[model samples]
Target: MSTGHVEYASLNGTHIFKLIGEVRAHSCISLDKLLNKIEQQQNVVGAIVDLTQTTFIDSTVLGVLAKLGLKLKQVHHIQAVMLSTNPDITTLANSMGLGQVFVILNYCGDPSVCTLELTEEQHVTHSAMLNTVLDAHKTLMRLNENNQNMFEPLVKQLQKEQDCLNHDVQKQNA
Candidate 1:
């Protein structure tokens, strides 16, 4: 597998750190250095870890990312977003429960990407909405399991009622 190369650029006031090639043990040092620079930079409001070009990532590299995430959360309060197209890496992150800790996003297909300018308030609102949706989904799944029989019947009744209401409305219109 090819070794990793760390690239840095600034986009829309955010620091973009792109990890190209395979992220093995050696890449951690360079990644750490880039992260440190971003942390020290006052103008950087957010950081994106672009892993679109990464072919492989070892556990050691994951450990480094975990540590960096923790440090950023504690010190700078900077939200680190991971943009990866690699299925293996995405699965690994999901299985490890890293998604809850970081803003992990998948960018598939077209590689031409641009930074989105989001206000601080908008970012917070979006994060809150995401959390609310996840919580609601979990609650719905739990309710479905708890009242499977009741839910199925209730859903059927609602569908029947909706059909009747639609028929009545059509009749009235006609």
Candidate 2:
């Protein structure tokens, strides 16, 4: 039910776009359009997609990114960068073999803390990689916390039922 919005900005010589809100089937159309526009930019050397604000991203979104990466590579010779703290999203991206296709950056609050290692013509340091990982970890933790809160009641109810079942078995034995 969440809507996805993308905000574009030029930062540190990179065309940075932050994907805000939920990335679902409906949002993919708009996202695809935006990506097409970004791809057409002559000044864009590379692209960084910030998914920290994105609460949900489905497989369709991943496919779109994969296609975009391919197009960018073939046409502009530009690489893509993914910046997100969502483990599910990250894991999905990794599973789809998109990790090797794009440069995944780790971002803590300050984007500067994150360093990107570019294979094309730019080389970055490992510390920057660490920072990016740390940032992603922070986002993962937040998602975990939110998930825990959402499931706490169901967990407690299941625990209560389990306790009751155990008590009934003991009574029958007695």
Candidate 3:
């Protein structure tokens, strides 16, 4: 059985990320961390996402990707190239209107030829994951009206869970 993985490297001013295996909601935690760091970078001139080895991507990961693309564009005026050979993924991306942010491709540049190592996964709490999911969906909703319509229910559900979690933490503290 294959687990999800997110690997990354920075070559000069170009940042490259490779998402492998099954990318699920939990993967968003790590991806969001990277994205936060990426957003703070000033030297990055371009970005690429390799999904060639990605077997599946959950909505949370997809939201993280959307956030990445929007950030790169807003910060650096760069359009992110998303590499994927899976027809299903490509179709799904199109259906979800991700093409507005990402330039989906079937192949990557020579970055894949380099020796890249996986980033160590940071352990995160269930609450943290839910928080990440909530933020990710909010980012998606901010993209456009269509996304807002599609993800409003999910965002509300996540927000409700987050509120409950916060209340539980307060009770525990009390």
Candidate 2 regions with alpha-carbon error over 4 angstroms? 11-13, 109-174
Q: Which residue pairs come into collision in candidate 3?
A: none
Question: Relative to the unseen true structure, what is the Cα RMSD of model 2?
Answer: 18.1
As a TM-score, model 2 comes out at 0.55
Model 2 C-alpha lDDT per residue in residues 32-88, reported as the tens digit of each score: 555667677776677777777677775545655666666677777877888878777
Backbone clashes in candidate 2 total: 1
Candidate 3 per-residue C-alpha lDDT over 1-174 given as tens digits, one digit per residue, 9 for 90 to 100 = 228778777888888888878877866666688789989988888888888878898777888888899999998899998988889888877666678899999874464355364554467788887888898789878877888999999999989999999999999999
Reference-based lDDT, each prediction: 0.57, 0.57, 0.81
Best by lDDT: 3
Cα lDDT of candidate 3 equals: 0.81
User: Sort by TM-score, best first: what order?
Assistant: 3, 1, 2
Task: Please provide TM-scores, in order, for all candidate models, with all chains considered together.
Answer: 0.55, 0.55, 0.87
Model 3 misplacement above 4 A: 108-112, 115-122, 172-174
Write down the RMSD of all candidates, one decimal each. Answer: 18.9, 18.1, 2.3
Q: Candidate 1: lDDT over CA atoms?
A: 0.57
